[model samples]
Target: SHFIVGLTGGIGSGKTTVANLFAEQGIDLIDADIVAREVVEPGSEGLAAIVEHFGEHVLQSDGQLDRSALRECIFSQPKQRLWLNECLHPLIRKRMLELIKQSTSAYAVLVVPLLFENGLDSLVDRTLVVDISPELQIKRTQDRDGVDKGQIENIIRSQMPRQQRLDKTDDIIDNQGEIQEIEQTVFALHKQYLSLSKAVLS
Candidate 1:
């Protein structure tokens, strides 16, 4: 079997940048966000199911999911959010598994933000934690997400804590430095994963 590395980090932690480094190394990347969107495409089974449960209000005039409107509804209502997650997660997970099975690379990278929170670590051979300080994470979240202090704090509180994430990771990428430093760490880890994959195959 090909190596499958689960890449995770808290909101605003540089997991996407690390995934890009893996892309540069020609590793297959299975991004859960991308899969989530795909499964909900207009007229898809996932979209149909969502509409059946949530009604047409969740869709745009053009019949696509009105993500902004949906986000507002979910963020304000926990029951709605959980119902939506229940409707979409299994569909997304099924599609992601199919894609992972079809990957042809020596190893595949699964970029999941909630890898530990969702217990998705079981799907991979190793876990890579992209680490950053809580202060840095808060600053980055506010700047990048255009969120307020209270909203950022709430989102952080909902996720698995940094300490718990660090405790479960098989490898760590410290991302509290310059972009070049992050790239260097990712390149080194890429080489290490490749070597390990080759040895296992041999």
Candidate 2:
């Protein structure tokens, strides 16, 4: 199996940008968010289960999962959120692990925004956190997502705290600067990961 790096950061922390840089280096990536969406895609067993539990209100008129409505439902009801997580987390984890096992790269990047929150650290060989200030997070998320500050704050509150995430990570990328600089940092890490993977294989 390839050496796996679990990449994580809080909402609006630019973790996706970092993951894309790693992908540019030809590293295979297993993005939990993508898998989450996949599991809930129309006609999937996961979506069927969701409809059974949450009812047709969670579906749009076109028969697809109504993501916005579902988000609102979960955010407003703690028990519903817990039930949904319990229902989907296993399916997501199963698919993610299967993808990781099939990867053919020197190392793989598993990007999970809720890595710590979901206790998924055991899935990877190391953890890399992208760090930024809360102010920047709020600003960037607002500019990109146009979501209310309160909603963004609620999301940040749900994830592992910044300090705790930092404490648990094996590496950190401070993403408070230019895109070029972030790419440079990723390139360096790419080299380091390549070396580490080679050493492990040897």
Can you give the TM-score per candidate against the true fold?
A: 0.89, 0.91
Model-by-model lDDT, in order? 0.88, 0.92
> For model 1, how does the per-residue alpha-carbon lDDT over 43-151 read when each residue is reduced to its tens digit?
7999898788778898999999998877877887989989988888888788878989899888899999999887788888899999998889889888888878888
Worst 10 residues of 1 by lDDT: 67-76
Shift of residue 9 alpha carbon in model 2, Å: 0.8
Q: In model 2, what lDDT does residue 184 have?
A: 83
- For residues 1-202, what per-residue lDDT tens digits would candidate 2 score against the true structure? 5799999999999999999999988999898989999998988989999999988999999989999988988987989999998999899999998998999998999999989889999889889999998889999999999999999998888788899999999999999997788888899899999999998898
lDDT of 1 at 171: 99
**What lDDT, from 0 to 1, does candidate 2 have?**
0.92
Best by lDDT: 2
